[model samples]
Target: MTAALWPLQQAVYAKLTGHAPLIALVSGVYDEVPEDAAHPYVTLGSITEDVDDAHNQRGLEASVVLHVWSKYRGFKEAATILAALDTALDRQPLPVAGFKDVSVAHQQHTEVRDPDPDIRHINVSYRVWLTKS
Candidate 1:
């Protein structure tokens, strides 16, 4: 179960970064956002995984969260980015190493106004199910 997590993350990162439309909207996608990272960027958030074996096969269900940050003065920019993110990820094929029957789906998302007032945040969650290779 643990083994599949990293590969899944790598696959997700690759998908996001490799997507031209999404890359054009943000500075970058990151697992760890740098201190001086620019606005309108994406950062990988929390992930929760659980064992879900069946029929003698090892399976796992993972919840992945991604955050979109923008200081564009409104939610429009952030919302656009979120749409691109959904386009890049929702129901899309993710090629995770050492895993098969991989599937990804958009679970939900929330738009938020940061306390800073100048910032807009959107939390996007995706559900992934995979069987060990």
Candidate 2:
């Protein structure tokens, strides 16, 4: 069976960047944040994948993390961005390369206190299931 992590990440990136509402809320969606990256942006975080094989077919389950960063005074800014991110991916149809029957769902999320008091962060996770095509 083929590895689905890269393709899945690409698909998620495309979905978030291409969504008008989501894009309007953030500077950009990035795999690697730039040194001069702006505030109120989204970054793709770690991924964990596992084998979930079924009779006569190969399946994979992946958990992807997305981080929302904002310099806004309160958690409200990060939360709004989180909502947009969730709406963009949760239960949304994603077309991943080399994979079929793909589905994404919101797993869980939490607020993280950055050491730098000025920064606010919200970490969100999504569960993705796909079958090798």
Candidate 3:
């Protein structure tokens, strides 16, 4: 059985960046958080995988976080970004190497007003189910 964490994350990156509308609205999508990045962009956050095996099959429940950052005046920009992200990933088939029939579901999301008073953050979490091929 192969672990699908990195493969799934890569697939998520592909999905997020490939969406034309999302790319247009945001500055960029990234796995690495760059220094001095432009506002209203998305970045890959944490990926935590756990065991979820079944009869004669191996599976994993992956918890992934996608963070939306904005320096806009309010939460609307971040909320819009979150919507695009949900449209891109929620209930979508994410292709992961060494895995078959990967499924993704939107778990939950949170919006945070940064103490800096100049930034807004939205964190979205998704649960991915991957079965070993």
> Per-residue lDDT for 84-110 in model 2, tens only?
988889898999999899998999999
Candidates in order, TM-scores: namely 0.95, 0.97, 0.95
Instruction: Assess candidate 3 and give its TM-score to the true structure.
Output: 0.95
- Residue pairs with clashing backbones, model 1: none
lDDT of 2: 0.92
Q: In candidate 1, what are the lDDT values of residues 1-133, reduced to their tens digit? A: 5567678888999999999999999999999989998999999988789898998999999999999999998799999999999999999999899989999999999999899988999999999998999
- Whichever of 1 and 3 has more lDDT, that candidate is 1
Q: What tens-digit string does per-residue lDDT give for candidate 3 at 19-100?
A: 9879988989988868967887999999999988989989998999999999999999999888888889899878888888
Worst ten in a row by lDDT for model 1: 1-10
Candidate 2 TM-score over all chains jointly:
0.97
- How many clashes does each candidate structure show, in the order listed? 0, 0, 0
Q: Model-by-model lDDT, in order?
A: 0.92, 0.92, 0.89
Stretches off by above 4 angstroms in model 2 are: none
* Descending-lDDT candidate ranking: 1, 2, 3
